[model samples]
Target chain A: MAEIRKATGFIDWLDQRLAVNKFIKVMMTEYWIPKNINFLWAMGVVLMVLFMVLIVSGIFLLMYYKPDIKLAFDSVNYTIMQEVEYGWLWRHIHGVSASVIFLVIYIHMFTGIYYGSYKKGREIIWLTGMALFGMFSAEAFSGYMLPWGQMSYWAAQVITNLFGGIPFIGESLVVWIRGDFLVADATLTRFFMLHVLLLPLVILLLIAVHFYSLRVPHVNNQESEEFDFEDEAKKYLTGQKVESKVVPFWPVFLSKDFFVVGVALTIFFYLVCFHYDFAMDPINFEPANNMKTPAHIYPEWYFLWSYEVLRGFFFDIGGVAAMDIGLAAFGFANVIFMLLPFLDRNTDHVAPAHKRPLFFVWFWLLLIDMIVLTVYGKLPPTGNNAWVGFGATITFLVLFILLPIITKMEANCKCNTGGCK
Target chain B: MRELKILAVVIFFTAVVYWGVEPFAHSQMHPHVAPADFAFKDLGVNSKKGDAAKGAETFMSAGCIGCHGVSSQGMAAPMDHASASASFGVVPPDLSTAGAIYDKNFLAALIKDPTKALKVEHKFNESRPHPMIAFFGLGGDIDQEIADIVAYLQSIAPVTPMSDKQVFADACQRCHDIKYDKLMSTTDKEALKAYMGTVPPDLSMMIRSKGTEYLTTFINNPQKQLVGTSMPRVGLSEKAQNQVIAYMEKVGDSKKAEREDLGYKLIGYMVLFTLLAYAWKVKIWREVH
Candidate 1:
């Protein structure tokens, strides 16, 4: 508490008023990250970079983009692309970043899962991160409708229609959400407001909470190694680096974060320029037309997995509608992410998935099933493709449903260093 | 180095997923649609070498200029665009680029029976006649008369290397519009909807929506791409078809060349940054472990 003598002039004045030095020291310089962590740990900074990119590029696009049904299409296609100088570059960056950010998020989440990073004291961090994921998804879905293209229109229509699967308030809830009978002018304006204003503001708040929640538990290491953060950080700070198994957040750890971010931006810029078609669906190029529906309608690539789950239930049981069952499954798939901390029954051992055989199999199957569902989702859900999608959907359910059973058995197993009682 | 290996594995898995979801699914969804009768064998029409001079005379004597116009010859249709479209579902196109754009064999079939050539014969019968009156003859052989009219059109057509925009204007403007380019269909919108049973889509993003290959097959025969569609087959020649696609790319994807160029430069910047970052990171981490 008595470490620093009062500084002279403006420095002492500002420090006394704002406590800025103490805040920086508590948040940054004294923060401890495990030395066993890999470059995957840097995804937080990468996401921040992507968020800034989206916010800045989105502001530029909002300048010329029109939200009206009549003018929305042309304002983007003609006015933004043609009339505005270098608007395409901003759009390419925005489009490509919007797409790639999801990939980074999945990797980040999986990394957390693999190392048992959400276990014990780190539940808040995981919960906040998942909340951020949900917010970003909503932001993306809302932003998609602002373009008012064919895919944009139909995707909104299909998503909003999901509300109709509810038993009592289904149809009326949908009408209230859309503000119209069909996906029309009202839908566009409301989604524009969400994309440009409300959702982003919520996401920004969630990002701050997610980052702050990590300060207590600290970042998990690759081996699930636990140590006193104060001791390791003090050792590193006093220049006894070899004895410490952690690095200070400011200078050493950020060096790795910066390098990882550099690599990520390289990959991102490459896609923005050379391979942008990955995000830009050709079907979306045509303006929204209620009269002419596209031959095939599908959601964006990132949402394809759950979209497949929603499309998988083809048969109804007794009197209930099959669509309602599929809708429930879709909701389960998304909500399961938030329940990871509670789902696993093993409270004693916090170890990497690879150290637990059954959980290892579960993790890999979940990843593979997600990829399969995504690919099959893009294909028309008919004939053999329907069967594959069903199998993938069932596999995803089974994997999550098995998490409790597998972790319980691991908890009761004979004594061992990993995944044992 | 160990962390880099983990990254490599992740990159490898990502590449596999990308291939499966994108290029692989795209190929499965839109298989290549083959061209419809490239040789025009099903048409069953034979012709002779026509004299351009005789064709020019027949163009007038046969009263071809009554409804259709040859803008190259300073011939305009008798009616204005509005009245012509109202009366005949679409305004008769100027035949200036017809010969250059439309295949010669297709042209001859179109003149003989306009309905059969456009493959909209399904919509037409004895009671509902095609808008274009069939060419009977000028008190002479019917095939020879058609050949003469075709020759006159070919002679009037501009030579090779016409701009892509001109080719599309000459061929598609009668029924379609590109709002982005500020170009509208010459025919009335309601008339076009009545004629085709659906309003034609704007061509501004056609190149992106339907790629070069898809557009080629679609323009060659609409039925092959979208079965039971009211859109008639347009008989643009292979060269002219390519030109129309090029023009679409120009308007729809105007920033393509610039985007590609800037992408490479930015990637180079990224490479330089990565190298510098690698060195600095290595220097900083040397203090630990």
Candidate 2:
């Protein structure tokens, strides 16, 4: 009896240290996540998982890649064609995952914007998330150059020169980033180190901080006001108390996430395995030949919008030189979206029809403008057509500059009339 | 729980659709191929005694020496054997094997017509590696000079045998001579005069082949037209002329300037770019935030 008592005591002590409740206790008891969070709220978790997938795959790639501009393209090719088994597979997965991660993050950002998650207690979280997003973009930019292919070479050349548009220090800044005049071995190696090591380390730290901030304040589930919790529970899950609802993560959300991942993986795999293409051109394999410029120069898709915006101003009000200013402005505009919650004082935490009339109209308008710019980005330039540019400028002003003013005016009027709650 | 499940499915689909398709959709999916025109498969090395001296001369004068390195020790890059085996690519031909690989007549013909060389003998399995830039002439006449060059190549050393010039280069203890005046004068004054007097000589019909240094000096200096030379004095400044002259002896006509210029231009642009990037970071992004 005495020996059995001693064994039970040890078992109890182990349970205290390792049980699910033990770990869950700190998160569940101290963290302020609202009990009412829906599956829509689970995107944060999904984003986190996608991030993990990218980091692991990225580390594997680093082991085989050589970043000297002379050898980078060939090294990537070597990886895909000769080096690692399923190396190409991992590379594709990582790339496709990047796009997916961005898409989810964008939606999450906008969701926060729509629901005022960036207001009040969540402002720090908002700031941290934006920082992460910025870092993520930098990571992508550096990684894109890792292949050192034609597109990678030219894209780095074009974007790095974008810094040259600055009034005084632009050219110097670009040189600093490049370490040499052209995107050569130095640029390749530096970017590789940053992509594979530095930026990722920053992201990991930032993501932890981002989540910690999220835990300080419970999530805002204000959108639930429209649904009668009791009635919805009965209709959806058979008379369960709204707060009583829960499910095992492993076979439920995890299964769904896996299914989505499977489909995505299939598409990525097919493209990489069957339709393999590196960004390099065989001519580019010789080395960077300055005498010959590739006939077409465009940035990667992630940077297309800013590239198009810069091009739009090339011959408009600005000459080729001043176009940098316009490009700078365009890039600056995205940053504005990131910093908006701090500027706005409203505390409403729902994507309701009312509280933010100005925000929604302008939101969609900016999106439409981006789409238009993207399409226009595909067109060849015609120097004589002032009309088209004037039209675009007017459209831009109306959507971005004018509409916000008008919406604000309308909001103030409604508030004065005591219609705002 | 069920409503949560529904939302999860929708989110999942949205994610899937947003991220998939591009890698599958692009045309010409393999790493891009240089257009068929750029692959010079038939390019064979020059191998004629009549023109061997001239071919050697041309090789040195044209800046090919700068990139290929002295005695073809191989400088810079892309010195791979397999790539080297390809008949022609962007990289210039290795002069060391010129004797064994090509006939003197073929070398003369290539000098006469680069495009023809690119299309024919220089090609290995594909097309030309570089578009045939006409450093010789666009059009006119070519005949006897080629024959003389080939004859000269054959008389001195058969294309199949290791030539005396290659042997001289290997045997001579190379020195850094400050005897620039002597070296320059050897080809500078007389050779340039001869080359300039010829004015884009008929490469296809060489009567007697001259050295590349002779041709380069002549091209750079070309005697005054009033002085009875077909080559005009382009009024090249002393520094400019000497640069071309020293270049002939030392580096020759490789891509040093081109690469250097690009580096400078890119640096200039980068400065401008960083300023604007900072502006976006500060003036616009910061203010808006």
lDDT of 2 by residue, B1-289 (tens): 7665656855664444323213321221223223221112344333332454553444444444443433333444344423432322223433444333334444555556644542322222234333334345222223444544444334433335343333322211011111211221112223333332321321210101222433344433333111233333222223333333333333211222443454455445545544544444343222112
Give the per-residue lDDT digits (tens) of candidate 2, residues A81-129. 2346756556655766776576667667766765667766778889899
- Candidate 1 clashes between residue pairs 3 or more apart in a chain or in different chains: none
What is the C-alpha local distance difference test score of each model? 0.86, 0.49
User: DockQ scores for all the models shown?
Assistant: 0.74, 0.03
State the displacement of the C-alpha of residue A210, model 1, in Å, after optimal TM-score superposition. Answer: 0.5
Candidates' chain B TM-scores in the order shown: 0.91, 0.25
| Candidate 1 C-alpha error for residue A325, in Å | 1.3
Docking quality band of candidate 1, CAPRI definitions: medium
Interface RMSD of 1: 1.2
Chain A TM-score relative to the true structure, per candidate: 0.96, 0.77
CA error at residue A1 for candidate 2, angstroms: 30
TM-score for each of the candidates: 0.96, 0.54
Error of 1 at A69 (Å): 1.1
- Top-DockQ candidate index: 1
Q: With candidate 2 superimposed using the best TM-score fit, by how many Å does residue A315's alpha carbon deviate from the native?
A: 3.1
